[model samples]
Target chain A: MLPAAALLLVFLTYPLGLGVWLGFTDARIGRPGIFIGIENYEYLWSDAVFWLSVFNTLLYTISASILKFALGLWLALILNQNLPFKSFFRAIVLLPWVVPTVLSAIAFWWIYDSQFSILSWALQQMGLIDHRINFLGDPENARASVIAANVWRGIPFVAITLLAGLQTIPQSLYEAATLDGASRWQLFRYVTLPLLTPIIAITMTFSVLFTFTDFQLIYVLTRGGPVNATHLMATLSFQRGISGGQLGEGAAIAVAMIPFLLAAILFSYFGLQRRKWQQGGGD
Target chain B: MASVAIDEVYKSFGAVEILHGVSVNIEDGEFVTLVGPSGCGKSTLLRMIAGLEKISRGQIAIGERVVNNVAPKERDVAMVFQNYALYPHMTVAENMAFSLMLKGVSKPESDAGVRRAAEILGLVPLLARYPRQLSGGQRQRVAMGRAIVRDPAVFLFDEPLSNLDAKLRVQMRAEIKELHQRLKTTTVYVTHDQIEAMTMADKIVVMHDGIVEQIGPPLELYDRPNNLFVASFIGSPAMNLLRGEIATGGSPSFRGAGGISVPLASALSIPNGEPVVLGIRPEHLRLSDDQGIPVIVAVVEPTGSEVQLIGRTAGGEEIVANFRERHSFTPGETIRLTAEPSLIHLFHGETGQRFQTRTDQ
Candidate 1:
């Protein structure tokens, strides 16, 4: 136990301490040894770009998380039914999560490109758009595109999680509903949805964290591009620390994200606890 | 009041038939129990009546309408399942009121229905509790309350008490009988327990291998079983069977394994050396001083009410007899026993069909 504790202290605690120290110091590219207290934090407070990045990150996280949850639940419900080739369809649904993220992002990039993208080509062909539209060139469209990409990737995880929960429910419950003369919607509303709440809450919490810290897909597709409209906290940290060589400012920005992430985790914790209490108190 | 009639119903899954062509006329306010062992299609037959399973062929009618394809909701039937099938999320009140609410009954009307059913089932205190919060018996009461609230044409029970412990099973069995007596709703119950069938059924349908063996009142079945299956299945500790041959003679004595003889009335006509199986209830065996067969007791089990003796005949065949008092005997004790001639049942060994005794006729 002592040896494992020592290892944890070295590998985890030391790095956290170093990151905190770096957040307060002016650890830039050329002036690496400077230690200026609170300046980096003050700069972050007044930074409009940082605030916009924060807003964009929250928007992407909330939208993508909600979209993934809805789509995943619908897909799970459909797949739970007695259908042909159910196992084959389930395997196909998992492909999005299993593929390499970089490859998927690159493929999506080509599909959303302004001139020769397949989606633009299909839209033009369908006469939905008057001309070939650049999906990622416009700021609003780019943010929406990145969110859609995140949703597409995360949907399989949520669906599989919810499917496992759905399978645990006994078939006798549905039969009981039929005997009670429950309509199709009532069975889902009273039986399926109430039973699935715990699983959905857990999966959505994980999805929020994954969407908030997402870097690879956005980097490969947009690079926080189209006038920095799609930049999340992770992307901005990467640009400041690695690209612009402002390591201290980047560290401060990264550290500023901690309070929001903690707030999210606490919110989820209280929500889950309240539900558990409600269920337990009834008994 | 409603009468349920099943006419020539057959059910099949893929190519394997689970229920053969079957028909039953259940009169209004009668409790009919379908009793059989596992894989006997009794539950399947009950589910067909409840409209839970599709009838592959023939017709079923609840009253005047032929309801071969009517949905369960439209058929006005409520079922109490073996596992109770109470919605885990809903309180007992909500579970009882769910069907009424679905039919767009007013809130007060539904609440009244729920309250009345709860009061009848003695479940008013449990109305606010969910299924997981209730005990097994409480859950069963809630299930019954749910059925009663619907006030449907017929009440169906699919082995609803099978999940309870032994003592609770007995208590609940009586409660169910009392409930039926008060409601007098046409009920079709399914179970694997013959005791339940005997105690609660107005008419018992005995099924075996997806075929009906016999349908009659409990005492009618006990006194006159149509076949070997019904004969052995309807009684507890089962009827003791001894194979012997009946010959044309004056006394018509039966021969046993070790050349032991037992007296029989000359009512049955049998060819010389025709093989037959004789069945006797354990309670019918007597310890007599007259000419009797001697047997070595193999095991003795004594309950306060009766003493059961497992013994082997001189022919090395095992037989069991129950005595009211403790016989106070060790294993291997030799005792002479005889069966009442009128109580003995004879069956053709080949066909497993009973030969009616004079009193039976």
Candidate 2:
């Protein structure tokens, strides 16, 4: 306990405290500065780039999380069936997650390359498009592209977790429902969905958090580029705080994201976790 | 209520055949139990009746309809699973009414159905509670209520009481039997427990190795089993089977190992020196004063109603005997035990089929 507590204090709390402290001062690279309370935050409140990044962050998180959930749940249901080579397919579905994020991001970089992308090549061969797609050049296209990559990397986590939840449901319930005259869709609506809600809530909360703070895929693919259209809160904070040498301003930007993260956590806790059936004694 | 006729049905999973050529004719409003050991295809047979498993060959008819291709819901059967399988998310009332709701029954009608079932099952107070909040017996009642509310043509129970404690199992067994009597629905139940099969079923279908060994009334099977399997499986303490051969010279007698001999019915006409197995129930054995098969007492267990004694014969064959009168004996004491000649069962050694004697008539 002592060792774990000391490690948390030194690694987690100390860095977090330092970042919060830095947010209040006018500190720069290689220079300690005096306190300038709320100045950096006030400046960020009026900054247009900061606002654009906030919008980008919301759009990226919402769209990516939604896409990840839908595709992940579909994959989970399919994998739950008595398919041939089921374990092999399940393990294959987890490849994107098992690979390092930076490695997958690099792979996606090549997939989205302007001239050599296989997707563009296939489309061109099929006479679907006349010219190459500017995947990372246009703002909207860049945002969508980065979100796609994030969804790809994040789907394995959701799919595997949801597949585990699906397996926990007893097969006897399905047989009972069939005898009760439930059509396939009715079984899903009444039996599968209700039982899977708690797991969905937890998995989606984690997915949303991961998408909201996503930085690696965007950095590798665009560097929040094409007029900063794909700049998430995380990348923008790093860009302003570390790369731009305005340590205090970057810390302030990073600190500003806490309220939204806290909101996500609170929403999942109050809105999703407190189910009536879940609040009971053991069966 | 409906009659179920299963004719020469078979079930195979891949290349592994589970049930082979099984048949039973269930009368309308009859309670039939399929009893066997685990992995003997009793549950699989019940599932095939419920249309949960595809019949590999042959036909199963429910009522007047050949239901081999019919869907489970269309077969008009409701099943109570071993685990109860109550929806954990729904309250008792909702669980009972789910089938009615799926059938597009109106709100008031569905509610009335649930209410009636709740009352019958004594689940009226628990109607608002979830399945997890109920005790095992209460959950079992809710499962039965769910089946009862449907009021289907047939009820299939797949070892529904196996999960409960011994006391709860007995109580539920009686409740299920009473429910069957009150409803008078054509019911087919599956259980590995012979006692459950005996107490609840109007007719018992004893299965072993995926084939129907015997089908008869409870007492018929208890008094006379068709083969060695049914003889050993039906009785509680199980019949004591001794390997021996029939000696036809003079008065017929059974000569077992270690110079042990017992009298056979004089009217028996099996060939001389034909190897056979002799079977007798534990309760049929009585203490002999002078001439009897010699046995050394190994263990004695006295319940309030009877004294159960386990002993070894001179041939080292273990034998069990139950006596209503309380008699004390030391473990190493040698005693002579005997059974009435008419109460004996003889089976041919190679075939395992019971031999007919004059008393069987």
Candidate 3:
């Protein structure tokens, strides 16, 4: 316990305190400046790009989380069935989640290449379009592309976690439900959904929190491109503090994401507690 | 309640068959039990009747319809699983009303069904609580309540009392029998316990190695078992069997392995020196004076009412006897035991089938 506390203090609490301190100073890339209270936050409040990044973060987190949940639950349900080659398929389904996000985003970047994209080439050859599709050049397309990429990368995590939760439910419950005259859809709605709610809450919360502050995928794919249309708070913070030489403003932007993360974590915590209480409590 | 017919049903998984051409006719409101040791295919037969398992061949009919291809829900049968299979998320009332709600019953009707079942199972006080909050016996009643709410054509029990403790098992056993009497449902219960079958079943189907060995009322199976398996499987303390031969001369008698001559039925028509196995219940053998089989007492256990003595015959064959009159016999002390000729069971040595005894006794 002492070791864990020490590690968390050294790696987590100290860095968080340092970031907050940095946010209050006029720190630059190489040299530290005098303390400037609320200056960076005041500038960020009126900065149109910062507000746009916040909007982008919200849009990306919400859409990507929803899509990830839908697709991942579908995959989990499919995996949950009694099919041949089951373990092999489970291993294959988890590959996207296991691989590094940046590497997959690099692959996506190639797939969405403006001039030599395979998607555009396939569409062109099919005679469905006359011009090459600019997947990342347009603002809306870039936002869609990054969110889609995030969903694709996040799906396996959600699916695997939800699959584990799905397995913990006894087969007898399904048998009982079947004997209760429940149709397939009603069984899913009444039995599977309610039983899966706690895990779904947890997995989607982590998905939302991660997608909200996601950086590597956006950095590799669009780099907040198409006129800052896909700049998540994380990517914008990295660009401002590390590359744009405004460490104080970047730290401020990074620190601003705490409230949303805390909200997601708290939602998951309460969901789990409710689950415990529903399971008859400590008695 | 509807009658259930399981005719020549077979269940196979891959290349291995678990139930082989089993058939049993359950009358309406009859409580039939399938009793055997583990891996005896009793539970599988019950599952097949419940439509949980597909019958590999032959037909199963509930009331009039052949429900071989019917889904579990369409079969109108409810099962009480060994683990109770209660939904952890739902409250007790919700769990009991789940089936009625699935049938699109009105909310009031569903609540009424659940309330009636709860009242019947003594679960009225626990109606709002979850299953996990209840004790084992209460959970067991809730499982029954879930089945009771359905008003099913038949009730299937798969070793439902095996999970409870000893005293609780006996209590639940009586409760389940009483429930069957009260509801008068056509019930098919599966258990590996012979005593439960004897107590609860109107007709007990004794199965061994996937085939029905014998089907009869409990006492009939106990008194006149057709095969060696049935004779040995029924009854607590089990009937003691000894290999012997029928004496060829007049005043025919059974000359057992240890030179113990037990009086055979007076009206007998059997060849001389015919090898046979003699079966005697522990309670049937009693202490006698001089003219009886000599035994060396090995151990004595008194279960309050009756004294069970484990002894060996002069030939070193183990025999268990339950004596009504208690005696303090030391472990190696010699004693004599005898049984009435009517209490003796004779079986063919080669075939393990019961030998036809003299009728005019």
Per-candidate DockQ vs. reference? 0.48, 0.79, 0.54
When candidate 2 is compared with the true two-chain complex, its DockQ is 0.79
| C-alpha DockQ for predicted model 3 | 0.54
Question: When only chain A is evaluated, what TM-score does every model earn?
Answer: 0.93, 0.97, 0.96
Model 1 chain B poorest ten-residue lDDT run? B265-274
Candidate 1, residues B173-282: lDDT per residue as tens digits? Answer: 99999999999999999999999999999999999987888999999998788778898999887887888888667778788788888888775677768888888888
**Please, what are the lDDT tens digits per residue for candidate 2 over residues B255-355?**
99888889988978899999999999999999999977899999999998999999999899999999999999889999999999999999888888999
Q: Candidate 3, A51: how far from true, in Å?
A: 0.9
Indicate the residue-level lDDT of A281 in model 3.
35
| Per-residue accuracy of model 2 over A1-283 as CA lDDT, tens digit each | 9999999999999999999999999999999967999999999999999999999999999999999999999999999999999999999999999999999999988888998998889899999999989888889788888888888999999999999999999999999999999999998999999999999999999999888888888888888898988887899999988999999999999999999999999989975855777667776
Q: Rank the candidates by TM-score, best first.
A: 2, 3, 1
Clashing residue pairs for model 3: none
- Cα displacement (Å) at residue B306, model 1: 0.7
Candidate topping lDDT: 2
Candidate 2, residue B313: lDDT: 93
Residue B286 miss distance in model 3 (angstroms): 0.9
Q: What local distance difference test score does each model get?
A: 0.88, 0.93, 0.90
Which candidate do you rate higher for TM-score, 2 or 3?
Answer: 2
Q: What TM-score against the true fold does each predicted structure earn? A: 0.95, 0.98, 0.97
Q: What is the TM-score (0 to 1) of chain A in model 2?
A: 0.97
